[model samples]
Target: MSTVKEAVDVEVPLHTAYNQWTQFEDFPNFMEGVEEVRQLDDRHNHWTTSIGGVRREFDTEIVDQLPDDRITWRTTDGDTRQRGTVRFESLDDAHTRVELTMDVEPSGLVEKGADALGMIDRRVKGDLRRFKEFIERRGTESGAWRGRVRPGDPGGGLI
Candidate 1:
């Protein structure tokens, strides 16, 4: 397994940053390799992405979530094996720091090679930088889901 961590500070309130992140389907707007994301439900999402010339489709389930704080997810099915968390921290009323940590298991030679070259880290850093620009330009979230998901809650507490 390989891990990549990246962070960026956005010029928005904690809630604004957090809320925008909750709109998973909007990820493609800022995420480089993500082609599309479909929110199956509050806690489930289907993703299509092309990285390193490889296209993959995956399903991910949110495992834990706390409004305006953090969200954690794991890939449930697909060609990818990974888990990650995105956390939001308030720097002040007008600034929020968003941090992302991801653990990925390379299943084949291509993925392993990409990992060895620090491609994942660069991709993550670029994504975060784009996210900062995206949210800052918008100045508000398109939508938000404030529901809390506890550790043992089914479906990550969609309700």
Candidate 2:
């Protein structure tokens, strides 16, 4: 397993940043290599991505979430095995710090090589940078889901 951590400071309120993140389907707009994301439910998402010429489809489940604080997810079924979390912290009323930490398992030599070369790390950093630009330019979320998800929640969100 390889881990990557990145953070960015955006000139938006914490809720703005956090809300934008909850709109999973919009990730393709700012997340490079992500082709599509479909929200199956509040806690389930289907993702299609092409990275380094490799196309993959995956089902991911949100494990825990807290409005304006953090969201965590793990791959449920697919060609990818990974887990990650994104956290939002208020720098001030008009500034937010977004942090992401991911753990990925490389399936083959090509992926392992890329991971060793720091490609994954760079990708994550670039993604965060793009997210910063995207949210800052919009100044508001395209959509949002404010339901809370605590540990042990059956569906990963408060109903």
Candidate 3:
């Protein structure tokens, strides 16, 4: 597995940044190579992505979440293997910082080569930069779900 970590500061309030991120189905709006993300439930999602001509479909389950703080998820079934976390930090009332970290498993020769060449790292950084631009331009979140999902919560978001 290889890890990628990146962060960006957005010109938006913490809640605004956090809220926008909760809208998983909207990821394609900012994420490069992401074709679609379907929210299966409060804690599960299906993702379709094509990167460097490689297409993949995957399902992920949120393992932990805290409003305005962090969200963590891992792929459950898919051609891609990954686990990731995104954290939101309030820089001020009008500014926020978002951090993303991921551990990914390369599936085949092409993917492994890309990873070795730092393509995956750069891709993740670009995604965060796009997300920063997206939220800063909108100035408001499309929607939000502030429900909490604690460790061992089974990702139901009942809290």
Candidate 4:
């Protein structure tokens, strides 16, 4: 597995940032490679993405979440496995910093090679940048879900 981490600051409140992120189905609006995200439930989702002519689908389970704070998830069964988390840091009442970290298992040598060449990193960073723009421009969350999990809690948000 390889790990990638990135962050961006947004001109939005922590709750705004966290709440917008909870609206998983809205990812494709900002995530360049995300073709779709269907929230199966509060804690589970089906994801479709295409990057560099490679298309892939996966399901993810939210393992942990905290209101206006953090969310973490992992792929359940798929051609590739990944675990990731997003953390919301309140810079002030009207500004927040969002951080994303991921650990992924490449499907094979070709996938691994692409990742090692920094393509995946660029995509991740680009996605975050788009997210920043999306949220900043909207100035409000697409929607919010009062999840069952709390920031330090586990096995609650992702079904």
Candidate 5:
């Protein structure tokens, strides 16, 4: 698996950032190449995406989640297998740090080449930057959830 790690500081409270993130459908608004993300249930989703010019579909199972803290997911079906987690860190009352780590297997030579050259990392970083801008401009969360999961427990199984 090839991994990419990126983070950005957002001008929003930790809860705002974390809550907005739970709105899976909103991802495509800021995330590049994420054509669609439909939350089938609290712990399951169907995703359609095009990365490195290759279109792919997958069903992801959220193996663990902790509201306003972190989320973990794994692919259940697809040409590629991926697992990742996103964490929210509070910088202060009005600012939060969002970090993401993803491990992926490229589906083809071109995709592999792009990964080797760090293009994927750049792309993911860009996505985070855009998300930061989008959220900060609004100055309030688009939505929110009060759920909380302690560090060790899997809050929900796949979402």
Candidate 6:
């Protein structure tokens, strides 16, 4: 497995950064190679990507979520097998740090080669930078979800 860790400090409040992240459908706006993201439910989403000419689709389930703190997910079924977390931390009332950490298991030779070449790390770092710019330009989130979810939750948690 290859692991990636990246972070960017955005010029937005913690709540603003966290809220924008909850809008998974907007990830394609900043994430390279992510073609689309469909929110299947509060804790599940479908993702489509074309990385290095390799196309893939996958479904991920959010295993743990705490508003303004972190959101964690794992692949439930897909062409990719990985787990990741996006963490939100307040630096102050007007600054926030967003950190992403992921463990990806390469499935084939192409993926393994790319992982060894550090393509995943570069992509993740670039993605976080774009996210920072995107959010700073907007100055606010397009939507918000303050729900809480624990591992194994069937999707009904209000705080």
Model 4, stretches more than 4 Å misplaced? Answer: 150-159
Q: Write the per-residue lDDT of candidate 6 for residues 42-70, one digit (tens) a residue.
A: 88899999988899999888889999999
Q: 11-107 in candidate 2: lDDT tens per residue?
A: 9999999999999999998999999999999889999999989999999999899899999999988989999999999999999999999999988
Q: Candidate 2, after superposition: displacement of residue 62 in Å?
A: 0.4
Cα-based lDDT for every prediction: 0.92, 0.92, 0.92, 0.86, 0.85, 0.92
Residue lDDT tens for model 5, 6-68: 999999999899889888888898999999999897777899998766898998877767888
Model 1 bad stretches (over 4 Å): 156-159
Q: Which residue segments of model 6 deviate by more than 4 Å?
A: 155-159
Model 1: lDDT to the true structure: 0.92
- lDDT of model 2 at position 56: 94
Worst 10 residues of 3 by lDDT: 150-159
Displacement of the residue 43 alpha carbon in candidate 2, Å: 0.2
- Give candidate 2 misplaced runs (Cα > 4 Å): 155-159
TM-score of each: 0.96, 0.96, 0.96, 0.91, 0.89, 0.95
User: Residue 151: error of model 4 in Å?
Assistant: 10
lDDT tens per residue, model 3, 1-159: 999999999999999999999999999999999999999888899999998899999998898999999999888888999988999999999999999999999999999999999999999999999999999889999999999888677543311
How does residue 148 of candidate 6 score in lDDT?
A: 89
Tens digit of per-residue lDDT, candidate 1, span 37-155: 99999889999998878899999999999999999999988989999899999999999999999999987899899899998899899999999999999999999999987766866
